[model samples]
Target chain A: DAGITQSPRHKVTETGTPVTLRCHQTENHRYMYWYRQDPGHGLRLIHYSYGVKDTDKGEVSDGYSVSRSKTEDFLLTLESATSSQTSVYFCAISDPAGGQETQYFGPGTRLLVL
Target chain B: EDQVTQSPEALRLQEGESSSLNCSYTVSGLRGLFWYRQDPGKGPEFLFTLYSAGEEKEKERLKATLTKKESFLHITAPKPEDSATYLCAVQATGNNRLAFGKGNQVVVIP
Candidate 1:
C-alpha cells in the first residue's frame, strides 16, 4: 500500500464529463490493475495492464479505459462519467516473480458523478 | 466462472471477543487465497496470503487458514480498531485475474 499512490483522492464530476484517476507506484511492479468497489457487489476489475501499452479489459470494462505509458504510472479514464460510475477506485500491483504473487493496493480514489 | 462468496454480511462483537469469518470460492485451480482489511473511506490493506490447502498464517490477533474450497479468518480478542470490512480474494491459475468477495463487515465495540 505504501508503494502505490492514487491521485485525486476524492473527486466530484458532472455526468458526461471526462475524468481520469491516476495510480503511481514506486515499486515498478509489472502487473497493474484497476478495480471499483461498490455496495452489494464485490470489487470488480475494470482493466489491467501487464506492461506499458499492453492492456486488457476485465468483467466491467464497458465504461472505462486504461493506459500504462510507463512502468510507474497507470491511468484509468472515463470518457463519459455517469452516476453508475460513482464508486471508490483502487489500484493494485503484483510482482509475478515472487512465486505466489500477492497484490498490493493503493489508498483509493473516491469519485462521485452527479 | 470463478467466484468468491463471504458469509455474515455484518458482525458486531464486544472487546476481547473472538470469531471466525468464512469465505467460499470456486475456481478451476486455486493459486492463492488472500485476506484484506478495508476501513471505511479507505482502500483495502493486504493481510495474508494462503497458498495451499491446510495452510495457515497469523498476524497478531488475526489468523487466516485455507482449505480446498474455503478460507477462514479468525480474530482473537479483537479490539475496537479492528472494526472494518474483511475481504476475501482468490487468484486462479486459469487466468491472471483475481476474484474478490463482497466482504464481511466487522465491528468490534469497546
Candidate 2:
C-alpha cells in the first residue's frame, strides 16, 4: 500500500554465491531500511539509508551490504551466501521530514541458501 | 542497549472475546514505540505509534496504550481476522534505528 516493491520475491542460491535483492519505492520517502526476519529473532535491521549515498549499519549487518544511489532504489547484497543467511528480507520506507517515524513495509523477499 | 520484550509468546481467543498483549521495553531515551501486525508470509503492517506516557491510540477494535516502561494492545470483541503475529518495536531518542521484540502470536477461533 506504500508503493514499495521488492524484486525477486523468492530466491534459492548455493553457498558462496553472491545474491542481491532490490527494493524500489514510489513514495519519494527519505528513509529506507532493509531487515531480515527469522523464527525467534523477529525482524532485525540489516542496513538502512537516510539519503542518496548515505548509509549505515544496523544490529545485524554482518554478511550483508547495502547501497542507495538514488532516492527511489535501495539494494541489499549478500557477498557470499550462507545457510544462516536464509530468511525473509523486508524493505521499508519512512518520511522524517513530517516528523513521522512510522515505517511502511513492502511485500518481502524469501531467500534460501543451501 | 535498548531491549524490547513481549510476554505470552502465543495466545488463543474465541471470536467476540476480549484480550490484551504486553510489550515491555528499556531504552536510554524514549522517542517512540510502534506496534505492527504481520500476517503469514508477509511483511509487517504499521498499526500505531505512541510517543509518550499516558497516550492512547485506536483503530477499529484495536487500542494501543503506552506508559513509562511498557505498552499494551487491547482488543475488544475480537474476530477471526485478528489472528496474526503482533510485533512491538522501540526507537530511542537521537537514534533512527528500532529495537524489536520477538512478537506475540494470536489465534482467534471463529
Candidate 3:
C-alpha cells in the first residue's frame, strides 16, 4: 500500500446520501489521484491533485468532487451517492522526479450504495 | 482519446509454467507504460514502467517489454503465489492521467 491509507475500508450507504472518502499519504508525493475500480472497467480516474489546493477532473469525474487541503490529504466526495457509484475506490500517489513515474496505491475503500 | 486494451480476461497456468500477458494501447503520444499486480481486496502494486518502444524491465521472475503499439508482461516459471490480477496502464504525453486496461486475472495452480 506504500505510504498511503484510505479511510472507511468498507461502507454501505443509501442512495441519494452524501459520502466522503479520505486518502492520506505519508510519502509527501506531488501527485494524488482518485480512481474507481469496477467489474469490466479496470480503474477509472475520478480526479487528481497536482499540489495542495490544486485539483483537476479526470476521465470519470462526473458526480464526484475532490479536495486537497494539505499535502497529505485528498478527499473524494459524492454529493449524492448513486447505485452506479458503488465500487472499490483507490487512491494513488506518484512522484515523477528521478524517473520515478510509477504510482503507488493505497489499500482501497469499498463503497456500496443501495 | 487514449485507450488501453488487455487480452485474455482470465488465465490459468500450472505452477512453473511460463506465459505472457498483452496490453495494447492507442494514445495520442506515449509518455510511459506501467504494469501493476493486484491482490484480491487490495490496491494495485507497481511493478515496472517502460518509457519507450523497445524498452524492457525485469523483476525476479517477471519481465516487461514494450513496443510501439503494445506491451508484454512475461512470467517465467511462475509460482502459485503469483496468482493475481495484472493491470496495465498508459500515460499519454501532455496528460497527467493514466488510462488502464480491464486487467488479466491469473490463477497459477500449484
Candidate 4:
C-alpha cells in the first residue's frame, strides 16, 4: 500500500495487438519496476525506471519496453502481444537513495492474450 | 544471474503447528535478503529484510533468518490466517534488482 496503483485490473486482448500497462505512484520514489508473475516461474522483472526519462531492461525484457515520462508514472508496453505474455503484471516502487532498498507493489494487472 | 530456490513447494499444517520454510540463493555477492507473504490473487506483502549473514527479523508469529547461502522463515504456532505463499528474494551487491523464489505455499487447517 505504498501509494502504488496499476491500471486495468484485468484485460483480454487478441494476439499481435498492442497493450500498455500503467503504474502510478504518489510517493514520488526514485525507482519503479515492472514484473510479471507466472504459475511456475515466480516473479520476473521486465523493466524498471530509475528516474524520469531513464529506463533499463530487466531479466525478461525481450518483448517489452517501458517509459517514464514523469516522476509518478511508469508505463510498460508490448508492441505485439503474444499468448506467452498473458500473465499478472505487478508494478513496484523503491527508494534506494533514501536507504530503503525494499520495493512495495501495486495490486497488479491481469492480462490474457488469446 | 542471481538464482533463488525454495524447497518443499508446499506445506500443510494444523492450527497451532509450527513450521519453517526454506529459501536458498546463489548470487555473486549478497546485498540483502527479503521475505514476503502473498495471498492468492494478491500482490506480495513485505515482511522482512535481512542485510547480512546471521541477521534475523521477526513480526507477529513470523521470524526470518539469513545465512551465507540460504534463509529460513519460521512460523510459531500458526493459525488458520497464517496460511499463504511465502516468497524469498535477494539483491546482489551491484544492483537493486531482486531475484525471487518460486515461493512456498502454506496451508494451515483449522
Residue A44 lDDT (model 2)? 94
Tell me the lDDT of model 2 at A17: 100
Candidate 4: tens digits of C-alpha lDDT, residues B1-110: 79999987999999999999999999999999999899988899999999899999999999999999999999999999999999999999979899999999999999
Ranking by lDDT: 2, 4, 3, 1
Instruction: Return whichever of 2 and 3 wins on DockQ.
Output: 3
Candidate models: Cα lDDT each? 0.93, 0.95, 0.94, 0.95
* Per-residue alpha-carbon lDDT of candidate 1 for residues B1-110, written as tens digits (9 for 90 to 100): 89999998899999998999999999999888989999988888989999899999999999999999999999999999999999999989856789999999999999
Best by lDDT: 2
- For candidate 3, please provide the TM-score of chain A on its own: 0.96
Ranking by DockQ: 3, 1, 2, 4
* Model 2's TM-score against the true structure: 0.98
Error of 2 at B25 (Å): 0.4
Off by over 4 Å in 1: A98-100
> TM per model?
0.97, 0.98, 0.97, 0.98
Q: What is the TM-score of chain B alone in each candidate?
A: 0.97, 0.99, 0.99, 0.98
| TM-scores (chain A) of the candidates | 0.96, 0.98, 0.96, 0.98
**All predictions: root-mean-square deviation over Cα?**
1.1, 0.8, 1.1, 0.7
lDDT of 1 at A108: 93
Highest DockQ against the true fold, candidate: 3
Alpha carbon lDDT of residue A32, candidate 4? 97
Local accuracy of candidate 3 as per-residue lDDT tens digits, A1-111: 478999999999999999999999998898999999999898999999999999998989999999999999999999999999999999999877635577899999999
DockQ per candidate? 0.89, 0.87, 0.94, 0.87
In the range A8-35, model 2's lDDT, one tens digit per residue, is 9999999999999999999999999999
Q: Which stretches of candidate 4 lie over 4 Å from their true place?
A: none
Q: B80, model 1: CA deviation in Å?
A: 1.1
- Candidate 1 lDDT, tens digit per residue, A44-82? 999999899999999999989999999999999999999
